[model samples]
Target: MIRVEEAIAIVEANSTKMPVKQISVSKALGYVLAEKVISPINMPPFRQSAMDGYAFKHSIRHQYDIVGVSQAGDHSNIKLKTTEAIRIFTGAFVPDNADTVVMQEHVMANKESILIAAMPEKNTNVRPKGEQIAKGEVVFEANTLITPAAIGFLASLGIMTIAVYKKPKSAILVTGNELVKPGQKLKKGKIFESNSVMLQAGLQTFGLEKTKVYRVKDNLKATKKALESILNKFDIVLISGGISVGDYDFVKEALLQNDVKELFYKINQKPGKPMFFGSKNETLVFALPGNPASSLTNFYIYVAPAIKNKMGFAEIHKPKLVRKLNADIQNTTGKTLFLKAKYDETNVTVLDGQSSAMLNTFAVANSLLIVPQEIEEYKKDELVTLLPID
Candidate 1:
């Protein structure tokens, strides 16, 4: 078995980002831009009023004549003299001679004229043309992540579509003879299958929602057939169970029979020592242990990064930090240990029920405490490294 760091490096070194494609900006949230976008026109497009008030050329006078009204979406051609003002609402186009606006609350209005309460500064309450952004300027650089605000900004700029990295197509294969569907009746010596749904949910968290799932019994022919069918059709293939060295464990041999190049067989880590990673052409394959907790942990540590890297993300790993341990813990397995725990900003506490087959502790865990092989014991208040789940 290889070390955990070595396994992670291997997976990252083999990943390649997907090709770019053009998509509508309305549906491009959470996608990374593949090219820089330039503004086609100046934001606001014209001199705009910043408030509902009277607009006129600023002068030393305290009273002025009100000529006409300018609503938000209409063009106003009203001419203003030196001591003349026009009623203008917010976002309305300002007349050519209007240089300043006094808010309606600060002025007294009458039938055909308004009296200013106080003399205002020149060019106040007016949004100059191109104030937000100028035309022909770079609005967003390459590798920018699309957010809700970004969508609105682009839509306001009349941008209908943008170029982005296409998300990878993925597939999952579940292999076990003693597994049954969740709603079905439990026969003798049978357990409900939970890894497929768990892994699917994990993938969906990273914007990989469209995935195909397949199931096969512990048979070599069936496993090989399943592998052969999807080996070249998808960018990632995740297989759960049948990777260990047992009589019914036929995943390794089936992968070999299908001409898949094995990158690594196992890792020197707890709860996931029998993990397998391989590749056939461009398809990356990960065969995880059948245990629900182990499968989910390996998915988060290994598979999540691979998916993110393929989608052209810069930061693929979970956020890491060092904090003091709230309670004592020990590791004597001579391998890296990943324990589910809860952490405040100051300290981390390892939760109970750290069994490989159980996910009770993981359900409440906000982070995974990493205990290296060189450390045997950690007392309370000792510093520890953790990967906080996002």
Candidate 2:
């Protein structure tokens, strides 16, 4: 069996970003930029008023006559001279001769002449041309995820459309004869199916908006039929359960029967050692464990990053923070473990229940306490890597 890091390296080596496509700025959110976005023109293209006030020459300190009124989107060029001011609203273009703006509250206006109570400062209340962004400047770089802020910034630069990487289509399959739908009556020894829903939600956090899920029974024929039907339709297939050594576990057998090339099966990790990975034609497949916690952990630590890479995201991994353990932790000598933990600004406490079959503990966990296989006992206050839960 390979180590978890080694397996991740293999997955990364095989993954590639999807093709780029042109999309409107509205639909570009969460998609990776395929090309650099350069400003076609200066932001605020011309000098405009940053406040609702009077536009006048800063050199004139005395009261001036109100020559004309300027509102936003008005194109009339009304230049100001000494002892002359123009009534201007916010965002209106400043005339060529005006060098400053005096707030309306600071001036007493009449029909013809306005009383200036305070002197205007040079360049005050003025939004200079290209102050926010310069023409031909790169506003966004390639491989960046287009967030809400990015979209707003691009739109401010008068960009209506952008080129972004296409999102990958993924199919999720959960296989187990003993598994039953959530609303169905449970039989003896049967368990409710939850891995499919959990995996789907997890994938969405990585910006996967489109996902298809299927439930296949624990049989070679049924599994093989399902794989064959969806082989070419999805970029990746996530299968849960029936990958272990038990006689009823037929997922590995079904993949082989369907000519799915096995990449690697099993890894040196707790609760996920029975995991399997393969490929049939161009579709990548992962046969995850049956336990809910195991499935989620495997997806986060491995599958999620692979899918993000395929979606053109440059940084595929989640953020990790260094935390100090509040109590001592003991584990086996071999196989890495991801223990559910809760942490705050001061300390991190590992949950008492660390079993792969337990779901309640994982529910309250804010982070995963990662323990290496070589360490047997972690002393209190020892610094460890904490992977945050999405």
Candidate 3:
């Protein structure tokens, strides 16, 4: 058994970031960059007009001769003289001598000349070269998550591919004899199996959808065989159920026999006291308690961080904030308790039915109130620590 903090530290120390791969910028969405990106050229490459109007050197004069038309993609070297302007459209490169642009609506045009409604500020309606990003500049640092705006920015600089951490592949092994698949008839002493589906949804939250779910009966030979078959096939293996000290519990023995080194067997927390963490080479193995709520909670606190760290998340820990308790709490000794709770901006209220097997309260919980192991009681309106749930 170990404290929650120690358990977290152990998981983090063993979870290393996954190897990097080169992928197209278009396909790199939601992936963390494994290397910095340097801009190969200036974002705009040249000074450009920002509006449909005339480009000319700034002047206080009211009229100017319209020398030529400059649309986008025009790269001609037509120079502008004083009292002369070019009919330019938006995104058109500014002529060599042009320093400003007056919008078409702001000027009245004649056949060969236009009257400026007023003397405008210098450099108005013009996007200067390298204004957004300079050539050879480091645009994004390593570990930065690629977003849609980032993709657009990189595309503007002509970036075709990027280096990013690969998402972890996962496998789930469910062990039990008294379980039945959902949508099937409920036989005696059997309940619907749900941990695999629930965990699949959780893994998808981190963009890890290439997960395989396998089932094993409670027999030791079957459990060992199942663990051995996929022990090296995934970056993470979640074994739900058969971890407690029951006659049918063979997960620990099977993991050890299959070269999975046990890092820890338990955590000093309510509902998840029987959790297990182990490793074989680079693959992480977690033997979660069979109770649905406990399995999910342990996964969120322990297993999720491992996956996230391997995926290059900057912060792999969940945040805990202090909020005033909306009601009193009767605490128990010898274990750190996690009670499903609802919290507003200023207050947190513990929900009812906090047993390890009941997930109803967790369904409506926005946070988990943390009750330290040594604490015995808490009064109303007391300050409490809470971890927000995603």
Candidate 4:
């Protein structure tokens, strides 16, 4: 067993980056860029009108000749002489020699001639070339996750494909013979198999939807067989249950027998003390506790970070904030406790149902109050560190 920080350090030290692949920029959302993306050319390419108006050199003119019109995508290579105005619309290229634009709302048109009731200042309503981004500017740094806005920006830069860290494919193994699929009638000691579904849904949030499920009976040979088969296929494997020192707990032994190096077997934490982490070459494995709440909590704390690391994310953990506790608290156990907490934007109150089996309170709780292992008691209104359930 080790401290929570030490466990995280071990995972971070061993987690390796996945291979990079080039794909369409539109399909790279939620993926980290493997290389810096630079603008290939100046945005707008030429001076453009930023408003529906007339483009002209500001010369204190109240009326000018409406020589020609310029609209978006028009290749009219028009130029304006002094005191000349051209009808223009938003996003249209401004003619050469035009340094300002007066909105149509402030002008009155009479036939082919127009009158400027008010003139904008010089260079007003004109989007200068390269104003948004220079040709050589680095718009996205390596390791930056591509977002929707990033897709648009990359498209504007004429980038069709981008190099991004490949998403890690994972396998989920839920072990136990006392489990049955949902919608099936319970037979004696059988309970609904939720860990596999829960894990798959959890992994999907990270855009890791390419997950396969395999259930095994609580037998050494069955567990070993599942481990050997999955370790050869997936970059990551998540096994729920059968890690504790129980009569039917065969996952730990099965993992060890298949040459999966045991990095850490346990942590100094509650709800998930039997959390197991191991690896073989580039494959990372997490043996989460069986209980639903414990499995989800451990998944957030450990498995999420591992996936982020593999995806080349720079930050693994969510930001922690300190909030005042609404009630007094005490902990005598020699292990850290991640108490389900309800943060009502003002103060944080620890929820009642904190047992590993209960997800009722866990669902309502928006944060986890971090109570140190050595701390005995805390008075009401005291500040406590917590991580939001985002």
Return the top candidate by TM-score: 4
Let me know the TM-score candidate 2 reaches against the reference structure: 0.95
lDDT of 2 by residue, 303-340 (tens): 98888888777788888988888999888649888888
Provide TM-scores for the models: 0.93, 0.95, 0.94, 0.97
User: Per-residue lDDT of 349-375 in model 4, one digit per residue for the tens?
Assistant: 999999998888988888889888888
Pitting candidate 2 against candidate 4, the one with the higher lDDT is 4
What stretches of model 1 exceed 4 Å from their correct place?
77-79, 118-123
Angstrom error of the Cα, residue 173, model 1: value is: 0.2
Ranking by lDDT: 1, 3, 4, 2
**Best model per lDDT:** 1
The stretch of ten residues in a row with the least summed lDDT in candidate 3 is 326-335
- Which RMSD does model 3 reach against the true structure? 1.9
TM-score of 4: 0.97
lDDT of each: 0.91, 0.86, 0.90, 0.90
> In model 3, which runs have C-alpha deviations exceeding 4 angstroms?
none
